[model samples]
Target: MLRADVRAARKRLTGRIRTTPVFHTSVNGPNGQVPVTLKLEYLQHGGTFKVRGSLNAMLAADPAADRVIIASGGNAGIAAALAAAALGISCTVVVPESAPHTKVAAMWSHGAEVLWHGTTYAEAHRYATDLAAERNALPLHAFDLPAVVAGVGVVGLELEEQVRGRPPILVAVGGGGLMAGIAAALGRRRQVIGVEPEGMPILRAALSADRPVEVGASGLVADGLWASRIGDIALDVARRYGVRSVLVSDDAIAAARDYLWREFRIVVELAGAAALAAVQSGVYAPPAGERPVIVLCGANAELGG
Candidate 1:
């Protein structure tokens, strides 16, 4: 089911979006990985890879769509807002009060009517989902939707085409949409590692217990990882497919953020750091001579934006 959806998603998003760059980063890490491919999706439009899903969602919707609404921690909202602006459609985004100001500003700058509701992404999602139903508007979910996940799978398409045949693995699991979609795109040929923050171990707990359990932990990375529950669609993808989950420390993620800035000069947010954290902390180490890949998904971190 997911594979079919992903194929349709790829066809739906062929030239609608830019295939972000994937690179073999040769820099110093906390560990001694000679070269790990880094999919610089941080360089995605609107400052994150979220544009892929947003544009795909918009394309999947009817052209005469009355309105669109979305709930997000930050990156997804910004992506949706930008897409709406391009299409000249009315978009209202529900965000949590806890979301960083930079993310809020990014959405507002794209002419999205921003609504601060609830205390976290899950709460905001509930509000936004209900509100969309009331208005008969399209609800652009942050990650749960098949369209959204398939849109994210485009990242895998780009990686596979760019990195020869059969890349080692992909490490980027927040909201699980990114991993689920990418895993679907790559099929069972490549390893898709689900990396999550230790503070908010959504996938780790889910894979361990073999079911989606709620253990919501709050952090700056909440926008990326504080999803109270896993997406049933995405979780089912991981289960039916072969997706491995790993947990990384918040401190390791912080160090990764700093390392990327100092080493690669790439100023990415905590979300992008999660993948690197998995590799550096030995939580999901690659086999000998196996070329591992990390998808640097989004970069919306700001100290005081």
Candidate 2:
């Protein structure tokens, strides 16, 4: 998607979604403690950035369409359900069995007909696609459509205007939609670095292979970043924009999650903490004098007492 598309999405999504706030904070960087900007996307509707795309897609869908369907690991399904409910349309979400119960319950609370199938998101996605065809319903992809990516690009537009000066951005990648959208929005003006869990480095693997390929997804945060393969649209945008990819270990992710909770009182999920883990673990060291921004992508974790 182009910058123009992102701008149009911003206008279309006006009053429909919240412009998540950005907070300045100090984190343990590679060279001792350093300042960083945190985009609190976890506070977004549906508790994730997925709402932007899902809502935009629904708005652009045919008015005659009465039903929507999607398959997600968790956050995206919740987004679709919320959007469908707001639009007064019927929605059915099919999630993998591994999806967290809290997420499924959230979808149900949002008035979506939820179903569980398969062991992985890919399998669930296939089932959802077939079901959509059978039901003649519009299918909303989690991160692989032009409108969805363009909708997500609005985050980059907001960040560019919010942050002082042009700073490199670190974003956690799942199917690579968020990274691609941000990179497309910023173009070559700012660096967009994608962070992935070591156990589910689909974007990193796709970048190395110069194409999307299937990879195993298993780790502390697999539920959010468990896409078996990166989307073709995301890969193409990353290549065109020269987006950098880094992988962080599960230990580092857990540590980063704890740090955010203890130090910042930010209860973000593992996927949201992955970007911070890159800096905290020295996996992605920023250049001296260059300020970096980290996108806290989600906050759907169950924090128990």
lDDT (Cα atoms) of all candidates against the true structure: 0.79, 0.89
Best lDDT goes to which candidate? 2
* Candidate 2 C-alpha error for residue 128, in Å: 0.5
Q: lDDT per residue, candidate 2, 1-305, as tens digits?
A: 78887888888899999999999878986679977899999999989999999888888876656899999988899999998999899999999988888889999999999998898888899999999999999999999988888888899999999998989999999888889888888899899999998898888888899999998767775553378899998999899989978999999998999999999898988889999999999988777777799999999987571
Clashes of each: 0, 0
> Relative to the unseen true structure, what is the Cα RMSD of model 1?
2.0
The estimated TM-scores of all candidates read 0.93, 0.96
Per-residue lDDT over 1-305 for candidate 1, one digit per residue giving the tens place of the 0 to 100 score: 45677678789877767777777765444577546888888888888777888878888886566579999888889999998898788999998888778889999999999999988787888899999999999998888887788887888777877887575665666677888888888788787888877777788778778888887576655553257767777788888777877778888888888888888778888778888877777776666676688888777878632
At residue 206, give the lDDT of candidate 2. 89
Clashing pairs in 1: none
Error of 2 at 299 (Å): 0.5
